[model samples]
Target: MTNAIQKLYPSTKMSIVLAVILFTLMMPGYISQYSVFPIFIIIAFISGVGTKFLSAFIKSIFVLVLFIFVFQCFLIPSDTVIWSKGILTLYKEGLEASLLMTSKIIAISSSLIWFFLVTPIKDMMFALEKAGFSKKFTFVIYSTIQLIPQMKKLSQTILEAQKSRGIETEGSLMIRLKAFLPMLGPLVLSSIQQTEEKVLALEARAFSATVRKSSYYQMSKKPVDYLVISVIFIGFMIFVWWRFFK
Candidate 1:
């Protein structure tokens, strides 16, 4: 099956993303924990991002979530003890607190991941530019987005070079830890050098010159874009009402 969500206009998708963020922020922790995740899980499954979501969750958010869970379980005291061993005690209250935080983080991160996974950077830049956003600000965001992959590739190259030089990256934990320092210096120096070069290039191109800019690509909003935007607005309003008036 095709991923229909990926086919939506960038503006429409961005509106939906903003709405999700607003909704997550407005709702209480308990409600967000109970509500936000299941909704996104379904959307992710339908959009064929379930595998990506799982991979992202594992690699990025999982560590933070685990840390919160462990921290709360140990430090927070409650009357209701779910588990206890010698010096360790797990409380129902701490579990609830951890779940609340985990859900909020997951909701926000998942929305952002969904946005980047489906929308091309050019399309995003085009949409923002059309919406009268600042070119300089957008350039920073766009540059950072492009820079991430370059840095990742650079790191991998540095690692391979070290391995080739008989730097034991594998073995005991201490050996790997010792290998890390050598990897760090080259990576940091190379990044700083590249950044300086980019700054010079941008200056040469008059990136800071105050003039209206034009995009080579054009983006036209479809009827579905309006419809999706309307739905998102209504959802935001409903959330506001429920959060404040209800």
Candidate 2:
């Protein structure tokens, strides 16, 4: 059976993540915001995408978060010094600011990353189309979302082709650099060539036809999906009231 989260409509998943992000942004104190990260990890595990989610998080956002933390701690102006050396010093206010900023960053990034990890792009596009988005608009959204993965796949194929031809892709750092340099030209040319071919294919298939298109894949928001979204919305409103009015 498919994972429960993977079965939910894309919009439902999106609403859940968006709620978490808004919560992280509005909630004061480092403990509250930072706590969202682990909660995301737990949700990822339950959703059966723990490994992929964590891998993407570590590869993409971990270093940036660390850099921001260190940078803010040392560079941001503050009156209270927490630690100091001749030329390097840490400020109390800076540390506090860094913690807050880093927590929000982690929370927001993890939410986005988790959402994408669990929701397929094809499903998202289908949902958008079903929601009355024009073909061209949905295609633009689809292409933008698929760009990075497509580029990575194309580059890997080119690298493999080079390797088959005895290119020295694996060696000392400089040798690998040399190998990568040769692939850049082919990669760019191939990408442009593919784009042209894709355009022609789309034209032949009447991609811009006025008739409504049908997709083989079908998705709908079930009762559980609506229930989850409602709960999230109510909780969000409650939090907003508690934060602002109460």
Tell me the TM-score of each prediction against the true structure: 0.75, 0.84
The deviation in Å at residue 37 for candidate 1 is 1.8
Each candidate structure's count of clashing pairs: 0, 0
Question: What lDDT is obtained when candidate 1 is compared to the true structure?
Answer: 0.82
Residue pairs with colliding backbones in model 1 are: none
The sequence of per-residue lDDT tens digits that candidate 2 reaches over residues 162-226 is 99999997889999999977899988887788889899899899986879988898988999999
* Model number with the top TM-score: 2
Each model's lDDT: 0.82, 0.89
Tens digits of per-residue lDDT for model 1, 1-246: 246677777888888778877777777765754476667667777777878866776798879988999988778898899989999999998998888777778788888777777777888888888889999878989989988898899889999999999999999999999999999898898788888998989889988788888877886888888888988898788878878998
